[model samples]
Structure formats: C-alpha cells, structure tokens
Target chain A: MPQIFRRGRFWIQLGVVVALMAFGGLLINNITVNLIRTGLGLDFGWLWRPAGFALAETALPYAPTDSYAWALVIGWMNSLKVILVGLLLATMLGVAAGAARSSRNRLLRSLSGGYVALIRQVPLLLQLLFWYFVAFLGLPDTPVGGLIHFSNQGIRLLGLNLSVEFCSVLTGLVVFTGASIAEIVRGGINAVSLGQWEAFRSLGLLEGVGLRRIVLPQALPAILPALTSQFLNLAKNSTLAIAVGYADLYAVSDTTITQTGRAIEGFLLLLLSFLLLNLLISGGMALMNGAVLGRLQRSR
Target chain B: MNRWLDRWLTLMLLALLGWAGWSCLHWLWRGADWTVVVTNLPLYAVGSYPEAERWRPLLCIVAVVVLIVITLLGTRHGEWRRSLPLLWSAMAPLGIWLLAGGLGLSPVGTQSWGGFSLTLLLTAGSGLLALPLGIVLALGRRSDLPVLRGGSTAYIELMRAIPLIAVLFFGQLLIPLFLPPGVEINRVLRAVVAFALFAAAYIAEDVRGGLQAIPPTQREAAAVLGLSPRQSLQLVVLPQALRVALPSLTNQAVGLLQNTSLMAILGLVELLGISRSLLANPAFIGRYLEVYIWLAAVYWLACTAMALLARHLEIQLDPVRSAR
Candidate 1:
C-alpha cells in the first residue's frame, strides 16, 4: 500500500506538469481558433490575395491591389530599413559618446552626461511622438524651392534624398538607445584598468592613442554582453513605429491581425522573426568579440 | 561684460523656453488663455469620465500618500518584513483616487482616462498588482516540488519570450474569446494585468537570484527550531532575500512605469497616445516637437527621481556589517 501510494504521488507530479502545458496549449489554440478558424488558413495563399490598400511608405513600389504577401513584404522591408538605420546610428552615437564620456575633456564629459540624463529618462513612445509630430511631421516642407517633394513617407533634404519614415524611426531609436550604449561603452573602457593607463602614459603614449590601442581592445568583453542586451531592447523598441504609421515588423503584424484576424499567427511570426533578429545580432557580436579576443590572445 | 554676456544667454534661453511654452500653449489651444488650457485638458482627457465620480482619483491619491508615508517609515526598521499589508495602504488610495468621481473631480473610469495620466496610472497599477504576483511566482519557480518548478519556469519564460506588445494584443483582442459569454474584461485592466504578469516574471528571476544567495545553513538553522518549510521561508529566509532584492525590484518598477507608454498602442489615452492624437489635429499638425519635448522632460524628471531613490537604496542595503 505504501509503495503504491509513493508511485501514485510520483505520477501525480508528472501529471501536473503535463496538465499545465496542456492548459497553456489549449489557451493558445482556443484564442487562435476564435480569432481565425482552425486549420482553415494557410501561408502564402493569403500572400497571393490582393492587399487592396496603399501603404503610405514602402521600400518596394506597391499598389493598393498588390498581393497581401507583397504588402507584408513591403512592411517587412520598411521595418528592416528602420532596424538597419537604427543599428548603425545607435552604434555610432553610442560608441562616440561612450568614448567621450571616458575622455579627459571636461566639456565632452559633461555633454555626454547631459545627453544620457535627458534621453534615458523618458519613454521611447514619447520620443517617437516627438520625432513623428515634432521632427519628421513638423519639418518645413518647402524642400529648398521644390528641389524635391518630401512628405511623411520620404524626404529630400538636399540634392540627395531617401526614406523619411526610416529616418524618423531611426532618429528616435538611435537617440534613445545611444544613451544606454554610451554607458556600456564607458563601463567597458573603464574596465581596461587604470594600470594600463599609467603604463601607456609612461611609454609616452598620448591619451587618444592609448585608448584606441590598449583600452578599447581590453574592453571588448565588458561591452559585448551589454551591447547585445541593448540590441534586444532596440529590436523591441522598433515596434513603437505603429504610432508614427511606420510599417516595421510589429506594425505589419498589427495590420495583418486587424485585417485577417490572425492574432496568434501574426504575433507568432513577430516573435520568431524578432527571435531570429536578436539571435543574429548576438551571433554577429559574439563573432566580432571572439575575433578581438583572439587577436589579444595571440598578442600575448 | 562676461556678466552681461551671461545675462544675455540666460535671456535667450528663457526666450527659447518661452517660445516652446507658447507653441505648446498654441497647439493645445491656439492663443487660448490659462482658463482655456485648463478646460481643454479635460476635454482632451477623461471626457467619458463621470463628473459625479470626481472623488475616486483624489481618494486614491490620498490613500497612496498615507500608504507611502507609513511604508517608508516601516522600512526604516528592516528590509524584508511583511510590509505587504503596509503596501496596500499606499496602493488603495492611488487606485481609488484614479477612479475618483465622488471627490469633486470627474470620476473617469479607466476607459475614459486617456493620455499621460492614463499611462502613469496603468504603469503604477501594474507595479502595485504585480509585486505579490511576482513574489508568489518567484517562490513557486524555486519550489522543491517538480510540478511547481516546471510550471513556473514555463509561465515565466513564455511570458518573457513574447514581446510586451504581443502580450498586450492577447490581453486586448483575444482573451474574451476563451471566457464564458457576457464576462468581458476591461481592456485597460487587461493591460494592467498583462503588464503586471510580464514585469513579475522578470522580478521573480531577480528575486530568485536573491533567494539563491542565502546560505543553506540559514534555512537548516530555522528547521532546527521546528519551523515548517513555509515558516522558515517566511520568517527566516524571506527577510534576508528581500533586503538584497529591493533595489533591483525598485529599478524594475521604474522601468515598468516607463514601459506603460506601450499601452498607448492598445488605444489607452496614456501620455504617448495623447501626443499621437494631437499630431492628427490640424491646428497642432506640425507642433509635435514642442509638445513631445515638454512631455519627455516631465518623464525625465520623474525617472531621474526614481533612479536617485534606487541608488540610495542600493547604498543603504549593503549589509550593515558592524566592525568592532
């Protein structure tokens, strides 16, 4: 009787785990079916159907009656545009400001301090609104005597022109995220050790040279993890584009949900896509960090 | 002349600030006076809120104030005491004040409250609700029972893996489908719950870290005194675990508050939503910069204060190791 009870209790624990997972799956399935009939929808078939709506700004030229796939494709491209630009701009600003924060220059230090304090404090949504309403949407539309006509979707700053939606989203994300990156950069730089600084000074190396050569090389590991984490944040922050009417992955996903009532599938795709994107980011950063570390190891 | 130059620069800055102020004033109500600005805020916000329910939000505010004072004083003694009851005094009034209508202010139900105030309330509400939820989730995740541990790991992770937006979407458009008919949940409340769950998962992980740090000897010591596992956890383990967890938890709370702006996407009239709405307005079509800057500045002020408070807590939390 005692053995039977113990065996039963063991099964109960396993049963409980199985039950929880089942409930979770049930909840997911129920919602998906309620949103869109189960087993009725298939991928790319919907892609073939006409989107029948003109997207405000698309990287690809698409008409109202374009394939739903094409619309999603266009949205995907538009999102990539922001992601690529946001990545570049944030890295540049973050690295530069972060480096400056560690600089001996008092003015530079204060400027970095002020930038971080102001940017890190506010929510990204507010920043996006500021960009959309105040910056992008509010820009003087004159376009230098009609040299080019730019609206909410695209822009013509001078003889050269490009995507305004991309620019706006990038600007918001970069400014917001760069503040975080700056701190990471500063921390990495500091982790290089004061002894290294003293040694470099004794060797008659200038501050700039020492930083570029000795400091940055040692600081790579310290910065990479934080930097990767911030990238995760950027990927998430990119979703705020729904406010400004920019069609990044989330925006596209949202539109698809509203149109097709496929909330689970749409968000599932978003989750997978972002997971892939973040993985790519971490993978690439990891490689770069390894290469840097390898070189350091070899140098020793 | 340096003095004069300083004066001129100050004047110039003030002029620029004044212009920003004017543009916001103009955008809010193109040349409208103070009375107009004040009146317009309600027209823009809490329009659907019942005037008879004005006392709710105010009462909430009063309750929050009293709760905070007591909790702050309560914490002067130890870091991990059963301050949960003490915390309610803080939360109840804030919740009541936010729902206020009978207190001579318009009682804007959650749906009616839009814009920045809505955003702040949603964040605060989620943080308030999530604390205990997070503690339970955290403790459960660390349970000796395999069932509890596995279930918890799944819930914490599933919620964490999905972007916050997905959670919000599920809460808003999807949850009602599974419920029995006529038992609809409010979307904003859903958002608060969702946000709370999301934040709690992260907090639980943080708390678990604190839980792990404590020596097994401490728990064993408590057991020797004939304490139950639960008692040992509550009386002996939790107090020390929480002392270390407070700063991180507070930091997380501040982060959740900022993240509440995402609720704007779900059509809540939080700060960001109001800013978005103003953008579509013809008069304020191009005045987004001034408005958003002002709004960002306000958020910055609040977050900066929280960051300082967190830093102070971190310093204070360092174990008071007395040297003889």
Candidate 2:
C-alpha cells in the first residue's frame, strides 16, 4: 500500500488538481471580498459610457462623445499605425546599417557600427523622450511664415508640422528596433558561408550583384525568425507611445481606468487585443517561413 | 561598373552625413540650454529625497558591488562556489535593508527613492527574484505532471502575449485592489513584483530552451545511479541547462534592466522619471534637449557596461573561448 502510494499516478494527479483548485478558490475569495469592500463589483458596464476625452492622434474618426469602447478601438488603430510604419522604417534602417557594416568603405562600416553600438546601449524610453521633448519640440516652431516652401508649388522642407509626441514615439521605436534587427541581419549574413561569395566571384559577378543574388537569398531563411521577433517587439514597444502622450491603446486604457475606475475591463481589452495581434503576426510569419523553406528545398 | 555604383553611393552618403552634421552643429549652437542641467544636477540624481539620507543609496550601491565582486571571486576559485547562492540571496535583503533602512538606520520611504540608483535597484532586485522562479516555471513546464505543465505553459504564453507596460499598469491598479483591505503594499514593492512576474515569463522561455537542449541520457544516467527526479534535476540537469542558457539569460537581464525605466510611469522617480521631472520644472522649461542628452548618456554608459560584462561572461563560460 505504501509502495503503491509512492508510485501511483492517481495520488499525484489528485494532489496537484486539489492544490490548484484550492489556490484558485483562495484567489477568488480574496477578489470577491476586496471588490465588495470597495463598493463595486466586477463588471465592464463602464465601457459603454462616454470616454469624454479626445485622442491626440487617430487613423479612425474619434470624438469626445464616443463610448469608452470606441476610444479603445481608436487607441488600437493608433497603435497599429505606429507598428506598421515603425516596422517598415526599422526594417529599412536595419538593412542599410547591417549592409553598411560589411561595406568595403571604412567610413561606412565605422559609422554603422557606431550607430548600432550607441543606439542599442541606451534605454528606449530615454530615447523617446529625447526625440519628442527635446529634438522635435526644441525646433524653432515653423517660423511664422512657413519654414520653407517653393512659391506656388506644393513642395516643402523642414516645416515640422507633425506632432512631437508621434514623431518621438516612432523615432524611438525605429532606432531601438533597428539596432537589434541590424545585429540579426549581420548574423544572418555571416551565417551564409564564404563559399557562396567565392562562387559568385568565379562567375565574374560584381560585388553588389553577388550580395543581392547569392548572399541575401541564403540569409533570408536565417534572418526570418529573428526578424519576426523584432516585428513583435516593435508592435509591443508601440505601447511606449503612452509615455509621450500619444493615444495608443495603452495610453487610452490608462485614461479609461483613471476616469471610470474599471481597471479590469481596461486591461482586459489591452491584453486581448495585443494577444490577437501577436497571434496574427506569428501565424503570418510561420506561413511565410514554410513557403520560403519549401522553395529552398525545391531549388535544392 | 561596380566602381561607378560604389562611387555614386559613397557620394550620396557623404552628402547626407554632411547635412546631418550641419543640422547638429546648428542645434548645439542655438537650441541647447546648459544652465538648466547644471543647476538641477542634484535633483536629477536623487529627486527630492532628504540630503541627510543620501548615504543610504550609496551604502546600497557599495554593498551590491562588494557582493558581486565576492561572488565573482568565489566562482573563480571554485572553493566557495557552494555557498555563493546563499550569499547572493542574502545580498538582496541586505541591499533592501540598507536602502529602506529600519534598525538604527533612518528609514527612507520607497517614494523617496529615484534617479539612477532606483533604476539600478529595481533591475537588480527583480532580476535576483525572478531567476529562481523562472527556473521552477521552466522545470514545471517540462514536468510530467499535467497540472504543473499546463499551468506554467499558460502563464508564460499569457505574459509573452502582453506588453510590459500593461502588466505594470495592472501592478499599479489591480494588484492593490485584489489584496485584502487595510493591507498596503507600497508602490515600489508593487512595481518590483510586476517586474519579477513579467521577467519570469521570458526567463522561463529562455530556460526552457536550455532544458530542451539536454539529452535524455543524462537524466537516465542520474536515475540509474539511484537519484530521485528532484535530485537529478538539482544536480545533473540544472548545471548543464543553465550553462547553455547563460547567454540568453544575460540578454534577458540586460532587457529587464532596460525595462526598469518603465517604472517612471508607475510614479517611481527612476532615471527616466527623474528626467521627466527635470523637464517639467518651470526653471528648466526649454532645457529638455540638454537634460535628455545627459539622461541618455548615463543610460548608454550603464547599459554598455552591462553588455560588456555579458560578453566577458559569455567568453568565460565557453570552454573553447576561455582556453584562448
């Protein structure tokens, strides 16, 4: 009987299950009592009420009279806007810097290396504040009569009309994410064996052609997983928009909670939306990975 | 053909660099305000904490640095290695006691803590707390027990899906609400809890990667030697797994350190928070640029130091690299 008790799966399972249940029960009991004492119950009815605040930036139409739910949607839209634009810019910057690091020109290599080292070493929050509060805001405001414009033409230069908050958040995300992506890109390039380059040289191909035709194809498979993580990171980092007074989902949620005292509902929307967004990104990337790998295999 | 293309690219890049240099020079000459940063240097360093209590944070820093040095020395000698965990664990409470101050020492409230020291404290505190919890979660995820496995997996996935900012918000807003009435957890403690819990998820995933890398034979060998599963895990499994996980672990530490800056939003006057406070000061109204530059430089220096230490550790840990 003792041996059976020691070795049996039944007892272990029962013990684990019971312990889990008891923990859950204790948590629920605490929350219930706490909620009762606060003169409030756990309900999301506050979300249906007016938000009564305007978003600083929104891709979708938003007004002060919108429901808190609509406010969250607008916040979500703004978050998505930053993520999409930031991802594009970060990828471009990453590729350029990553490629430049391996350039024949000593100046290009050192410049890119310095950028990666400096940018990656600082916290993203500080960089965001710098870009927004200092870099953008400190710019002498569009000199009364428009900074620069061609006569009767639509062209303009250094007008600086974009919101400082938005510019800061976007620049911060790009600079930070781009540094990481550059490292991944550099690693991916290095992982492509030197033999490929030699093969291109034997075929009398130019350096640019060799890199584009021979190196990048091989590097893509290696780069994709890391690149996907960076994309996810940028998406999440967009939440830093709150710090700069940008009305991203997190910022809006903070306002909602402050206004309505429904922390649970406010955070639940944030958690669910982010989870869905990440699932979509990962799922899309997985499909792309499969397609790329399948093509590589067929070519082989 | 290649030369022509290279020449055109280089020329364009040079022109771009020149324009950037000119703009920077112009800004430095006309825009920057130096006096604001100079006058508020003390405020940036320690917020508005009492001048008499200044030695507390300094003591915390000295104790932590000494503990780290001793730990490093112990590991290098391999003689005091077994006691290292005990010593390391003690350092956290010790550091806290020194900073928070209770017996004979003047008590400095959590609200009083701010600036670079607070940032470092949060990073170190959360990191130390999270490592062991992360290892357990990683093990639980890999365990045969369905409940433990399911629970850990759920936790890690849920945490990974959300941003750190949201988790912190919940820490500030929800955690207090869930606690029993009349029980007060200070804001700094709440932020620390949030950071540890948040970091545990990522650390678990990183550790899980290490655990997965271990071959079945090592565990089987431990079993054949009459070792219990717990013994096998504590002795044979964890050492090898952690060795493999060290680089990723260091990366997570650096990331967590950086994430501690988010504490500013929770109203902790850490590095970024202190900077914001400086910017908001009426006297320093337009000196945001100069202050931010200083803040970024400090972070850059600290982060670079940590990154370099990580590189050194990576080299030391790798048998092939260390031999050279």
Candidate 1 residues A79-183, lDDT tens each?
Answer: 777777788889899988998887765556776888888887788877777776557765665655767766664687666566666667888999999999998
Q: Model 2's CAPRI class?
A: medium
lDDT of 2 by residue, B102-203 (tens): 998888888888876688779988898899999989987887767777989999999988999889889988787777677889998889899999999999
RMSD of each: 6.3, 4.1
| Model 2 chain A poorest 10 in a row by lDDT | A148-157
Clashing pairs in 2: none
TM-score of 2: 0.90
Best by TM-score: 2
- Cα lDDT tens digits, model 2, A1-300, are 001123666788788789988887877877788878877787888788888998877777889998999998988888887888898999999987887777777778888999998888778887887777656665653433566543221224576335667767888999999999999989999999989988988999987778877887899999999999899989988898888798888898889888888777677777889889999889988999999889888988
> In candidate 1 chain B, what residue range of length 10 has the lowest lDDT sum?
B31-40
Contacts from the true interface found in each model, as a fraction, amount to 0.48, 0.69
